[model samples]
Target chain A: MLAMSASDESARSPGVLIVDDDAGIRENIADLLSTEDYRVYSAADADEALHVLEAEDIDLLVTDFQMPGRNGVELIEAARKANHLVPAILMTAYLYVYEQLDADRRKDITLLRKPFDADEILREIAARLGDGNAPKR
Target chain B: MTIPPAAGPKAPPSAGADSKPPGNRRTLFGATILIWAVTAGLGILFSVFAVAIGLQAATFDVMRWLLALAIEAPLAAGIIALIWYSRNMHSATAAGEAGAQALAHSEAKYRELIASAPDGIFVLDPQAKVIDVNGAGEELFGLSRAEIVGHSFMEFVPPERLESARSYLADRLKGLRATELYEATFAAADLKPLHVQLRSQVVRPSDAEPYVVYIVRDVTAQREALRNLVETERWASMGRLASFVAHEINTPLTNISLLTASISRRVSDPEIQERLKKIAAQGRIAANITGELLKFARPGAISPIETELTDLIRAAVEQTDAFRKPGVELRDETGTRSVVCTVDPMRIQEVFVNLLKNAYEATPRGRVRIRLQDLGSLVAVSISDTGSGIPPEIQSRLFEAFFTTKKKGEGTGLGLAISRNFVASHGGDITLTSEPGKGSTFTVVLPKQAPGVRATE
Candidate 1:
């Protein structure tokens, strides 16, 4: 579902795409960002998430580090190769899974542990967005 | 004859003097001593007679008198030497008898000790054949002493272990190894398999054959008990792992709370509203799963500090609210005032949650009340439910693990047992009071200040 943005379609709010195998978590992230009046995109897996990235003008990418196939890290790298630089946040239950990310790839990418509060998620997305089409607090 | 090994593989010099010699050399020595003694005695008697004859026959000549004096002095010395030799011979005979008696006494005592030993004792000769066995050994094989002796030890060892058992006995008897310890199955006289532990030691008796002395113990009962203890611990650990596969539960729970909160706010239509309630219901189920895991967990690492338990009690009540039957009231009678106690806040919360959950489970839609009190040194927390009370007979065994009044799939039956353990570990106790059809109350009494000796980091 396209989480309805509060503003008009002509100046669509900056888009944040959330990709996770879990429907509840994917929809909840979308649900959380929708309150900020930003257009939110939800995808069930990496294939679907990549499809959304291709179709939308996604400004921020939020993805779970572990998925059924081709985890969030691989998805973001693939997404970045196709087009422009999109800042990413990777949520994982295991922190050690991302410890080996090279110095170059670590830049503009944030690691978040799971079972996190929704407020924290909003803060990170806004920080990554800076003032450029940043969602309302 | 038994020669004590303390003498270093040789006969004592004093003992040899009294022992009978092996060959004609002994006869020669005896004859020589007799001849010398007799010659000395006869010389004494002849010297006396010669001295008398010389005195009677001699005139007052100086030469004759001198000769008579010399003869008399030599005879007196010979007689004195003979008397000393006779006294030595009598004492040697007495010493020999004493040594023989002492050897007899020690051998008898050793035999008695082996016969009365608790563990089966068997003496095996160099060929691994049983030379002798004690009374216990006979009982161990379920055979008479005559039947057990002169039998190869390999006959009693089960076929599967025969090779190892053979080599072990061979090594011990050859003195290649001083001792051998092993567990093996023994085929008793009735052909029943028995688990026996053998401790075999090499005993080399002086100048005699070496023997392997085995101390055998029937360890079947002991092994069974040890196996049961290990299995019980494994079952207990596996029991806790049931659905709270932590990470699996957490992701869904995180989604549950956030998505349900969002849906309930945005949607206003009755149809969507009904679906949102269902979302809340699933969310509550996830929350219950987390609470149940904590309720059964050892509260993780223990962190005890002085804190108000009232807050903890209220939090636990809130945690269990989702699981309570609809319309069942969990009234926390604890006032807002701090009921201070030194304890692991997490553990106390777990105990409270477990008790409240039990109360909620029993009372489908009735009232469950929690009351806390500070009686100077002791703090008492009581949970009472208006559900059907437990029977008098079953209530006594309520705290035992795997003993549950709840139907099979409903309970692991370990919750109360673990809760009671936690309470008791903190120098506290959980007491139960119940009447059939009148509901039940479980009271947990803890010291206001738990004496501190242990803490886990």
Candidate 2:
């Protein structure tokens, strides 16, 4: 369910950053998204994810909203301030965060539930990148 | 008239003599005129006697006849006395009627003020019976003015409060004493007890019997409301302290349970080891208690993630089945929709599980119904149980920590309370509606979207 860029033939594979407080969750999601041929960078929390984003040309971010120190929502806001256009998907165990999203941010933001299916995550990433009807990204 | 002082004393004081001069002025005037004519006649007679016998001795006799009328004027005096007496009698009668009318007007004004006073005023006789009551007084006692009048004050006073009522009446009977205010319970016609505070006094003239004046006010509802407010605050503070205590105890408790389980695994003898396993099992149960306790105290940090509500609700139902018996039926009513919302799925799942567990426990082998409806910006989920519903006594305190109807080992009573707190942290609330002997429905309402979305298809 991921679409590849036309410039992919000339350059490296598209990079995806994974930010979650739980290490197990970070590893599991990174492995699943990697099977679809996207390069993956994993961060334990907001601070680590910011370091990864600065060093890499990341196309997508999948982060949990709640974390120690800087929370996931705060991290998303900071990332947007640093780079004006970056697509992000926030993960939550609790159910009510999506309804609270702002209209501007919601247009770019996609939500994924915890313990989510691999196929569902891949398809959401494909749709958000404006690759309509593509099988892989 | 001036003949002699000696002759005045011997004269008879008849009406003719007493009216001889000023008292008989008209008669005197007429008599004098007659005398002058007679004297002139006598002189003419003397003169004419020389001419011819014209003025004779009869002329002198006519003068004496006029003098007699001047001395007694009986008919004229009688008429003056009758006229004076009649005029005095008529004026005296008119004055008496005017005085009577003024007295009647003042009495009517006194009656008006007594009847229309704003506060209830009751006039009780010395015998402690109601002599008069104002409109306000009759309305307060829920009795007609006629029913209350002439009735003893004891009739409305409940039997339990009769002594208090008598002491109150006794104070009113003591004239010139300080006024006393007392509260007493009275039974209404509907058999409900009423609370009344009366300010009563005895009023009287210096020599008259004392009359009781009572002013009554009702305060039953006001007092009850105040009591409920105080009771609620007490429970709320207790719950807050319990949560803090649980948090403090949980840290050590976590280590203790872990150590006990490790030691139980190291034990050697089979029988001794089995007993140790039991000990570890009990320690683990204690750990579960602290875990639930921590849920109440710790705040959840979660991110917005989209998931289907029906699927989440089903997961809660599945968890609830662990405690349900074979006879129990756990069912879900979920409509097909994207039913999408961004939430912390784990926390939301926790809330659903708590509600479903509560519904399962409320009924024994009864049907549990789980319903989910997408309500625009939010979603409403209801978990209902067909069990002996919550008693009214406990219903109000159902969310209070450590308040439970279950046996000591069965419930810590923090499930609903923690559920309430968890829902509130996400800007939602848990509400419980119950009817005794019928059933109970617990509803959890959560905002379907995250913080900033304007809902769209």
Residue lDDT tens for model 1, A1-137: 36456346524678888888888788788877777768888887788888888787888899998799899998889888887489999987544456457679888789876656555677788888887777554
Q: For each candidate, what's the DockQ? A: 0.23, 0.03
Expressed as tens digits, the lDDT of each residue in B1-457 for candidate 2 is 1111111223221212223223334444455556555555555554444333223545655555444443333333334433543454445445545544543454345446656666567777677788777787787788998899889878888998888678767755754346755777778777777887778756553434556667777777877888899976775665466556654454344334334444444566788868766765665566557656645544344555788878887777777788786778877687666688776677778888877777777778778888888889998888888988988888889988777888887887878777776666566778889999888998888897656422111
Tens-digit lDDT track for model 2 on A1-137? 12222245524555678787766556656655554556678898888888878877777887887789897778888888888357888775333466466687576777864434444566776666555323353
Highest DockQ, which number? 1
Q: lDDT of model 2 at residue B277?
A: 64
For model 1, residues B103-176, the per-residue Cα lDDT tens digits are 55755666677678778987677788887778888999999988877888788888899998888877776667
Query: Which regions in candidate 1 have their CA more than 4 angstroms from the true location?
Result: A1-24, A35-137, B1-232, B243-246, B249-269, B294-298, B310-339, B360-380, B384-388, B391-441, B447-457
**Leading candidate by TM-score:** 2
Question: Residue pairs in steric clash, candidate 1?
Answer: none
Q: CA lDDT, every prediction?
A: 0.73, 0.65
